[model samples]
Target: MTTQANVDTRISEPDAAQISEFLRDHPDFFDTHQDLLAELRLPHSSGKAVSLIERQVQVLREQNETLKSRLLELVNVARENDRLSGRMHQMTLDLLAASSLVGMLDALEDHLRNEFKADVIALHLPGLSETQLHESGAENLVVNETLKELLPTPLCEGKPQCGRLKQQQLDFLFKDQAAAIESTAVIPIGHHGQGGLLAIGSREVNRFNPCMGTLFLSHLGELLSRMLQKHTAG
Candidate 1:
């Protein structure tokens, strides 16, 4: 037979998980044993012992601060989205007001350079010949088979290709400006990209990261496709 003292010594102390489970099971345990809050001490970040209640208050304060920071971030994102929408609305009005293909191209170039912060812009449409486009006043906006090849790839589907492009891809799109462009947004224009493509180059590397959302690009592609049809038909 084991001695009573030996049996008491063998009793396992509850682990942190066990204590957490017990508290979860009996939320009202504190109601009955409120005095434990004063007796129990916890190690704080400042390397000092604090009563359980004080530690809990500190934890709650930290959590409250984290929540506040997250809320502010969400607010800032919402404001940015609102600003982008307003700019898109203005661009649409400008596109509608354009009288000809050259007018549309000039309007797009102006908006991208001045308002949208784009460093260089290139457009490639399949139906129109290079000579015709150049005569219409579009320089470096070539009509090429590259647009057809790119549309079938994952990079140019509904999602579009963003961020740093490969050496060959950059050379084909940007030409002389390829080395200067740190990042690019390649929007597939027209149905299944049959109409062509639009490339917006930026000097900043992070301007078009792969992880960024492409919903805006998809909308832009659709808008450009429709606008091109209106002009190219005439």
Candidate 2:
């Protein structure tokens, strides 16, 4: 038989799991036992004892700091998005004001080089020979049957593609500038790819990658196709 002293000691020293489960079940227990909160101590990383209230305050402070950091990051992203939108709006306005295909191409090239930071800009319009485009004052324009085969399935479906290009594709698109280009964004203009395809090449190998966002590229292609249609109608 256990003595009264043993019974008292057993009641005071409950199993760890029992205490943990009890606390987990009764989260507000400390709220009711306000004095016990101040009495409880936790081992500090500095090998010193800290009051439970102090430890809780430290944890809350750390959480607050983390939240502030994330908020700042979100704010920076929003500002950057706003800046990009402003530039894209300006570019659209410039494109809309173009009176001819030459003007349109000039606006496209200028905005892409200055705003989008493309190192090399090349265009391939099918069915139109280089001589025909050159006669129309578009000497930089090109045409190649291999361009159709080089386009990825996404581009065939009228979507933009971003990533490193094969040497053959780069050579066909950039031509003389192929030696300098390391990556490229290939954007197919028009729904059926009749308008043409635009290639924006970069010297940075990782600048255009498969993971990059293509929303801007898609919108740019649509705008270009519409502009080309106007030029053709004129």
Candidate 3:
């Protein structure tokens, strides 16, 4: 009772599910017919059709390039860190060789200016004798009890702070050069904020930020504090 037209209408194309099932069950089919990988084309983002193998090769090449770029970046970072470490060590040695507090401060300022690229370096030490201050040219030494109050509470707690300071605070530290400062890193020296602070200021706004790492600066502060204490004790 089936006519030729009815027979033609009854035939159906394979659905996506059937094709997927067949491919899943015959996983080795592509291995056996490797030419099919080259024959099958996928639409690329560039509106060009690329063979499956070509697409896979392109993806691998891109990943390889990314890895290479990342590796180079790491290498550059390591080299930079090594250079900075060398400079820091050399600065420490110079500080140790310094006989007087002025010599130590001069060394610190010189290294910070030449190596660290700081625009201004100031150490505000409290309780230093007038004679010592004048002899050392330590104009930044406040020697007053209110110096700690000039800094924020967090920094007063003996923490390193980095960011833009208020105009008044900048003036308190840098004086006339305060107008030129855009950013700063304030490293607290001594235990319980007794000794004083080391201020590093820059003309660039982005030179120091709140999120910058303080580990190295903190270690430098401690080292300088011990040196100061020893000098003062003598």
For candidate 3, what is the TM-score? 0.76
TM-score of each: 0.87, 0.75, 0.76
State the lDDT of candidate 3 residue by residue for 75-146, as single tens digits.
998898799889999999999999988788888889999999999877777778888878765554553447
Q: Write the per-residue lDDT of candidate 1 for residues 1-234, one digit (tens) a residue.
A: 999888887676677899999999999998899998779999877899999889888999999999999999999999999998998889989988998888887888888888789998988766676765785543343334664464334234545788888878888887888999999998877655566678899999999988988888888888888888898885
lDDT: worst 10-residue window of model 3:
136-145
Sequence-dependent TM-score of model 1:
0.87
Q: Which scores better on TM-score, 1 or 3? A: 1
User: Highest TM-score among the candidates is held by which one?
Assistant: 1
- Summed over model 1, clashes come to 0
Question: Please, what are the lDDT tens digits per residue for candidate 2 over residues 104-143?
Answer: 8889899999998999898876455565478443324333
Cα lDDT, model 3, residue 195: 72
| lDDT on C-alpha atoms for all candidate structures | 0.80, 0.81, 0.83
Which structure among the candidates has the greatest lDDT? 3
